[model samples]
Target: MSIGDGYRAVVDLLRHLRFFVAVAETRHFGRAATDLGITQPPLSQGVQKLEGHLGVRLFDRDARGVRLTVAGGRLLGPARALVDAAEDLLDQAGRLGGPVRARVGLCGDLGGWTPVACRALAGGSGPGLVVPRVAGSDRLLAELREGALDVAVVRHPGVVDGLVGGDVVGLPTRLLGADGPLDVPLAEVDRPLVVPPRRHQPPAHDQLVDTLRRAGHDGRVLEAADPTQRAALVAAGAGVALETSPGAQASGGLPPLRVRVVLPAARERRPEVDHAGLAAALEQALRR
Candidate 1:
């Protein structure tokens, strides 16, 4: 009456459970084999081996179709749950070897701040970005709330309800145009304004519009998605554009044009996420 003598069997536990589940679901060995993409003989042999290991018959054979025995009926639910948990564990294990991803959104990458923030987040080592999505400030904020983005670096005057953030830097802005001499007051310039889409950054849009109206312009503006396009329109004498200060453009190799500091710099910050560790990392990155 040795312990090993009573129960001696070798079986791949997970494989046996999977085979049992397939057979239990179909109730027909032939149908189960077809579903599992295997031959009926191996399926029958696996089920027999599983029953021998458990020391109980899991199914009843008849002329119509197979049916679950008392033991099989009791084990089906737990077996399915176990298989699901095992697959999920395997998936997480595969991700453990890869760098953790942080989805970041940007409001037009103005003044080249988006790249700077991304480098800071990477800390010079590990996976950097999951393809930064560019949208208006309003859309970016909305994405942050919807759990689509882990963080976002956006401009001021945009609504950020139910989110926490910290200002990382201030990007001083200037007016670009062909008609005005560089360094004049905003009121002295007289050119149709070329601005990014107002729907994306309404606060900034209204500020510029109101400021120009006081200067005697009719409050008319042309919309362009790309800063380069804005600069092109201004260069071609189509209109003036509010853009990053001249100092910020020095390294970007933008087309040369008359520039004057008008509106002050906009604040750049990151929206909060749920995880404390990740939020701390983002705060640290913005500080850099």
Candidate 2:
């Protein structure tokens, strides 16, 4: 076989090349499996496939562990180099001509994350129009502080120093449960609440709490981070969870939740921006 063709044959091997290499570096099959978060049987099979492709043994096994054969030693650096080069290429693409990426928050409170930003996902990523997802919350406050996101939709019970809310709209706070729409006022139900923590509290939670008490029943907020978990808890007949305008119902055992504005007390909070210029550019692009 030609030398270039031989190299290509070795390089084209599937999964086990890395598995074999990891075992060689770690000097233990168990360690390699742990590193890859997989079981050792599959790791052994991968190594076997890789060795078969090369027509040479890749490692020397012993009572203690494994060590690389001469053939294995030769392949290690090149394999790692290939993986690193691919990662670098991807990172560069995300930063350059890929899309107009932004971190935006959308909650019952009509924050600065305009419909335009969320709508970008409907369109593919390109020069002026990539709505790559970061997260969905005023939690942009954290990302903005870390300088990771270009702009974010942030809301407050009060004002932020540098950020400003976009042409914001007010979302109605509603009582949501496992079935269709709920008609009872908050004072009537004596259920626990699934809610975002105060640090991550969306505007609807605050209104739900206040409206519940005013309507006559006391309100308490139970904290859960994942939406599906909250829905599951509700399905288990745990209690009533608050629903905001933008979030949709999750599928499976969870009943489609109900929503209606039982109170007029709550209002919309504004999302703040740091650089008006970036916000303006994104907003303009999103409008298209």
Candidate 3:
């Protein structure tokens, strides 16, 4: 295609990418239409137009509704970025002389250090507004990579390309039991293990799994996407919960359980930044 033709095509793709993203996230035409405040037919047509422009099928339709095709999956990350960037552009245009805004993502409080970090960032005399988002580690990391987030606090945040982490704090790991504190050895506990989902932070999960295995545990492991839910499970005698003591306490009031330090400490995931200013700010926050 000629340069002019390619440019127009790109513009057209941008126009319909929002519809594609809505459908991909909702996975249902009707819901996507409702969310987009448009009729189902037009929404479907817009998606079709996008598919035609890209020359790839974005979704597979069946009685089970819609599912993203492999091509769709590949496009999802970029599509989301396009939509976010468009929104940001509009926001920035509206706020033309306002302070710069910084988007921050937090992965489930990062063992109660999140609040402190927030305070540190807020206390900064810098000329930027900080907006925070709370989400799972995996989702936070993905957004961070996509430029949707300026900085993020995640658990066991190893090394991410293009981003450097700072303000590392060691979180003391604990095991909680139901109804009260129990001194039961790891090998003696037979209940399921209720903890964060492994996919969100595999390194931390693997370390926990290895520790349990060494203690002779071969029971079922239950995945809890939220820390409060995991603590609730422990309170109900559903299973044992392994997490930072402060994090579990921050989750909410729960049934009393025996608490023991299974691991002396695990480092809290702090801000992953691309700028020296952000790194310095986070380091200052960690000191508080």
Candidate 4:
């Protein structure tokens, strides 16, 4: 018998599940320590403890490096699955009331946003924004999946293949007022770009990256952690950013800026996916 056998015999275990999984994935104790944001000796001790409890080897450890043993490779799949299930459970728990709140992503200003959309979600006919400020499409969608938001509004380049889309359109094409010609091979170097994180980047990020890459220039992307800071950076001409704000008419105290609200090009049009279906599905999940 091995430490692994004893470890798995219990109906449940705490803490070490993640640590064990990390060791199996990375193989090296030091590297796994770094990934877990801890130190090397502790990670090694924990893995040893797991092995001792299970009564079998989980890793082939040596000075050269670490690799998962047969037992570990077998356990890795199930362990990873467990982690995913736990995350999904947490996400479903965080949703709001019966109706569920939907999030919409706005690429441009809100002049084109219909009032009907806002009123339906606000749960009343009071004076308020429809989508409010979601920062960007990625943030809104993450909220949507996590049950924080039931619906989201996003611009479609028609490239997002799997998830359905609705009201697809490009945004106003505001030129950032370059010192040179509008179309002259533009490039932003060292300047900060206010954009979504790679993990949560929206269709807009992809399109913008493509555009910059085609022009032989890589744009710097600053994650949208702080909307105000991101906005300020863009305003100062430090970088270009995608934002959703109340239209100029509604933006009372905000600085006056002229931006081209470029709509999606014809090739970028996406088919309308039913918002009703998404709402229904979300509601059912919360009930359970």
Candidate 5:
């Protein structure tokens, strides 16, 4: 093949490699397609094309789902690296034509920590602009996967597949009730547990519910969409809600909820941003 033909072949291979990586990580063509913003047929075809080019079976399809073959497992890391490199090249090229900005997502429950975290990120010498988007943990995760945000402060105990980061900080919480001892046992609260919708942060919601159950509270749960609503419900004698304490020492008796700093797994080591330093700063600021 001519040099031009060879270049086209590599480009074509990279396209297929993206498909391979997505499917490999998600372990399901349907979910991968949705994540990739494509239909299932094209995704399947792209993976098939990649397999044909590599001369190996990458995945075993079964009734349950897809599983990586031995060969696939071996090549997955390298394939991810190549795809990430290509994306980085494009990203850097785009940066050359414009001012650098980092889109950061913060969880809704950060409360007083929100302003501090924003200042920490914006004050950095890294990006020329720091845009902050606030939402629930699940929504933030989706935006990260879709490349809508560069980094996110997400709630712990939630799904973070295909991302890389560490726990940044934890905020202790206290039970807020209209009229009761602050140190009352959860089982003795008598009112329902007021919390946000489970769909917003499924794992954290389940963890909270399970902990309450274990603490002997098997009563009804009142769903509220935001902190204000939860607080209002608590004040109305509807239920007791967990609210972040002013300081670590203020925790009534519940476990602290944690926040983690996560970026796309592919961009974890990108030199454009100092994610670790930002996380450390957040930990310090939030702790105060």
Candidate 6:
């Protein structure tokens, strides 16, 4: 094959690998497609192509769900590395041609503080564009480690292995019930606690549950995917939601949920972007 043909083949292989990794992570074709912003048929075909090229069945699909084969499990690490390396190379190329672009990820429950932080980052005297992605703490950390994100403001008590930073900001949370806001003890409320799924932020979820239990709330816990859903559940009298607010006073309430900025430990790879300076800017933004 000519060099051009080889380059195209490598690109196709990378696409298939990306599809495989997405399906493996989500364990569902439809969900993976949604995450990848593609249709299910194309995603399935890509994964199938990858399996065929590798001469192994990567995923076993049944009526219930998808499960990875042993070969797939073994190849997942290297596939992720390849995908990350490709992305890093593209990012570096972009930086070489233009101003540096910093990608920042923020936790979903930041409420009004999200916009404030975005404005601060965008308006900074920094040299390039500031792009913000919003997601759960777990997703942010994973992206940070994979080199997809330059920095992230994740919830405290997160799994920050291979990353660095510390608590920088705290936002007070209020318990919202069907009638309205409630300032009473959690135990006094005779309803379940509505929160995001534990998988999204394990440490924060476990800590919140433990704290609630100690406060005498031995009730059911409803897991919602986002804050809007949680608030809707509360409004429908399903449960009470702990809603964070930037305007909330911290004088006499439950301890505010803390946020911290973190960057990958391997800073030498992309010396063009000042990760520490960006982190400091984010910390100041969240504080304001």
Error of 2 at 5 (Å): 37
TM-score of each: 0.50, 0.45, 0.56, 0.38, 0.64, 0.69
Q: How displaced is residue 45 in candidate 6, in Å?
A: 15
| lDDT at residue 99 of model 3 (Cα atoms) | 59
- TM accuracy, model 5: 0.64
Count clashing residue pairs in model 5. 0
TM-score of 4: 0.38
State the C-alpha lDDT per candidate. 0.62, 0.52, 0.65, 0.48, 0.77, 0.79
> What shift in Å separates residue 125 of candidate 3 from its native position after superposition?
7.2
| Candidate 1 lDDT by residue in tens digits, 1-288 | 223553332225555677899999999898786555455897889888778877889999999889999999998898788767866886577478475466667677364455654565566442453446667676677666544566666766555545666543445455667763245555565667887788876776787677678766678888888877877898899987656532453322222221111111122122222233444544454443
| Candidate ranking (TM-score, best to worst) | 6, 5, 3, 1, 2, 4
User: C-alpha displacement of 50 in model 5, angstroms?
Assistant: 24
Rank order (by lDDT, best first): 6, 5, 3, 1, 2, 4
Best model per lDDT: 6
Off by over 4 Å in 4: 1-120, 123-149, 155-162, 173-194, 197-199, 209-224, 235-237, 240-288
Q: Tens digits of per-residue lDDT for model 3 on 91-140?
A: 67847946565677767735455676666666757424678787876677
Where is model 5 poorest over a 10-residue stretch in terms of lDDT?
244-253
TM-score, predicted candidate 6 vs. hidden true structure:
0.69
Model 1 misplaced regions, further than 4 Å: 1-97, 123-130, 167-169, 178-181, 215-218, 249-288
Model 5 lDDT, residue 216, Cα: 79
Candidate 4 accuracy as lDDT = 0.48
TM-score head-to-head 3 vs 6, winner: 6
